[model samples]
Target chain A: MSEFFSMGGYGSYIWGSYAITAIAMIALLLATLRSLRNSRIERDQLETVLQARRPRRTKKAPKAS
Target chain B: MHRFAKPSVFLKLTDPLLPWLAGATAILIATGLYFALFASPLDYQQGDTVRIMYLHVPAAWMGLFCYVGMAICGAMSLIWKHPLADICARATAPIGATFTALCLITGSLWGEPMWGTWWVWDARLTSMLILLFLYLGYIALVNAFDDPERGSKAGSALALVGAINVPIVKFSVDWWNTLHQPASIVRMDGPSVDPSMQLPLALMILGFTCYYFVLLILRVRLELNERRIRALQLSGMFDERSDQEAEKANSYDAGHNAEASQ
Candidate 1:
């Protein structure tokens, strides 16, 4: 309703306060999520590369008679 | 506890938690906003101006809560040298800063209509302004050093010192007579607020709590990965050293074998 939007003439202040707060909160959430996603990918990639670089151990056979 | 610091374990623990927290945060915020904006009645004293309380109060609560969280994490890191504690403290800094900004901004907006100005040097507002400064100072000090360990240590010290302001901000109106109102929601007696006002306020607090959790988890996960990268880089250095050592040993053995045959 227009009443809800207007907030009885205090609409600008009320809605502005809410809107800025909401945007800040959402922006924070999105940024946090994005950083988390990026970190996960980085961790996975680092794990893979480190695994590949790790030394492999193999046993040597005894000399033939 | 250290085992949980491992990225894999952290990831596994957080995987199930993220969805639940995200969902809860969404529901709480949505419901809270609905009640706050649509269902709650306007104030007689301040008309719709009191609506700012729904956002302002929660942000103020979170600002306090986060600083406490940071200080506790800082203590853990300093005493135990726990990596996760350092990570937690680091991750929480920005979140606290954001909440403090929200609190100040909403407070200013509320003040403009009620006080005929956007800001004042009142004790509560002044102390809150100081709290925001403290948060910014902590963030800056934490990242100022070239050595991350040194930075974390310095940051912990700053966090502990800054915690003295948290209580001051909470009680400033009581300690000093100021234009800012005293506690109406939580007092020695029952809350002075009406049920209609209280419901949306309560919902906003709940929603803010969930929001903090979501942000905390995300930040913690990011910090863990950052540590993982550091560890991998160190491990790479180790592998390179081992490769060179093995090459040297192989060449020595080959030279001795050739000499013995000759």
Candidate 2:
């Protein structure tokens, strides 16, 4: 309703405050999620490369009884 | 406490907590918004403008709470050299800075209509501005050095010293004549605000607190992964160098054998 939206002529201030709060919160959530994802990818890539570089150990032959 | 100091154990415990905290935050914020917009009665003096208090006050509270939390973590890291404490303190800086910014912006928006001014250098406002600067400074100091340990040490020291501002910000209105009003919700007498208003305010504060935890867990995990990556890379570099040295020695031996046979 227009009445609710108007907030008795204090609509701009009320809406502005809520909007800014929402934006800031959303932005923070997105940034944190993105950073987490990026770091995970980077860690995975590094792990794979390190695994490939690792030297394989050969099995020892059994001794004659 | 010591059990969780290992990042792997900390992650295992907190990974399960993140979804639950995030869910609670969503529910609480929704309920708070409903009450704030529809259920709460308009203030007799400030009218609908008082609605802004639900957002502004909670954010300001969170800003202070996060800073205090960061300072405590800093102290723990400094005294005991707790590995996870400095990471926690580092992770907290940006979240606290965001909340402080939200508080300042919302307060300014609320002020323009109520006080007929966008800003004023009153005791409370100035102290809050200083708090924002402190958070920014802490974040910058933490990342300024090539050695992350040195950066953490410097940042922890700064956080401990800057903690003096937290109490100042809290008591500024009482200490000096300021345009900002004295404490209403937290006081010796009790909350002066109406029960209807208090409900939404409490909900919002709790929602924000849960939200902070959710973000903290995520950021801490990111920091741990970063440290792991750095360690792996360094070890990988050392391995490559040793392999090259072995190859060089073998080639030299082969050439020496050829010269002897000739």
Name the top TM-score candidate: 2
Give the poorly placed runs of model 2, Cα more than 4 Å off: A56-65, B1-5, B245-262
In model 2, the Cα lDDT at residue B20 comes to 98
Cα-based TM-score, every candidate: 0.87, 0.91
Summarize candidate 1's per-residue lDDT along A1-65 as a digit string, tens digits.
Answer: 88777877778888889999989998988988788788778878878887776535111112211
Predicted candidate 1 versus true structure: per-residue lDDT over B1-262, tens digit per residue: 5674786776788889888988988888788888888788888889888899999999999999999999999999999998888888998989988999999999889888889889989889988888888888888998899788899999999999989998898888899999899999868998999999888899889889888888887888788777777778788777766656766877889999999999
User: lDDT score, residue A51, model 2?
Assistant: 81
Clashing pairs in 2: none
The candidate 2 chain B region of ten consecutive residues with least summed lDDT is: B1-10
Q: Score the docking of each candidate (DockQ).
A: 0.70, 0.77
Which ten residues in a row are the worst by lDDT in model 2 chain A?
A: A56-65
lDDT for position B235 in model 1: 80
- On DockQ, the leading prediction is 2
